[model samples]
Target: MAAIDEQIEQVERRFGVQLPEDYRLFLRSRTGMSQFVPPADDYLMLDSADELIDINEAGEFQERFPGSLVIGGDGARELLTYDFRQSPPPLVLLDTAASDWSAAIPQAPSLTVFLDQFPETGWIWGGDSR
Candidate 1:
């Protein structure tokens, strides 16, 4: 697999925008979603649920899938995490799990697999972004 930075850069180049500083930092700090959990409003308020993803694995999502990351947070605070994205060849979802109470993505197979999604929000793990 490519280095995290390399993967991030690839996503940015393909998407045509620089991710937020905090987002970049988060990516640099993590390697995958193994350490992450669903966040509150991860499904209802953000534009791209993918936006709520850990920064570390963000690039991996981009590499696996190329379309925008929509995340909806508390009370209609919807926002687009990754805009205008796409997926790789022969789209498929990999290591993805979603249930009535949880959704976990070990690695995504394709971007299309993530549409119409909701994260296991209402609780979150990890330190403050502040």
Candidate 2:
């Protein structure tokens, strides 16, 4: 189901950053995938507004990966995030096993591009392909 504006506001307040237009639009349209959705596992399953805060806070992402916010994951080690380290933050994949900057793989130039191309591009674990 679509997320309410208040939910999005809570996320913004928790993260202390204004989300990109594309991402906000996504939230307005659909908060995340439902359990009944296909491609249920090991895929980029987006987190709900509350889940976004809980997961990021639990992981201590700000201290560990400054300027980054965990948006979703593969239900395991791989995480989908927005790298706020750059202007107009790019979407990236982070490995939980590796705790360094090198572990990050640039997925797309922006959330807009990622959402637009994900169906065709899919996930790339080997290296950066965007």
Show where candidate 1 strays beyond 4 Å: 34-67, 70-80, 83-130
Per-residue lDDT of model 2, residues 9-127, tens digit only? 88788777888988887777776863323342235678876577778887556777888888887667888889887888888899876676678888898778876677666666777
Task: Compute each candidate's TM-score over C-alphas.
Answer: 0.32, 0.83
Residue 100's lDDT within candidate 1 is 15
| Model 2 steric clash total | 0
- Clash pairs detected, candidate 2: none
**Candidate 2 Cα errors over 4 Å, as ranges:** 1-3, 34-42
Per-model CA lDDT versus the true structure: 0.36, 0.76
Best by lDDT: 2
In model 1, state the lDDT of residue 107.
Answer: 21
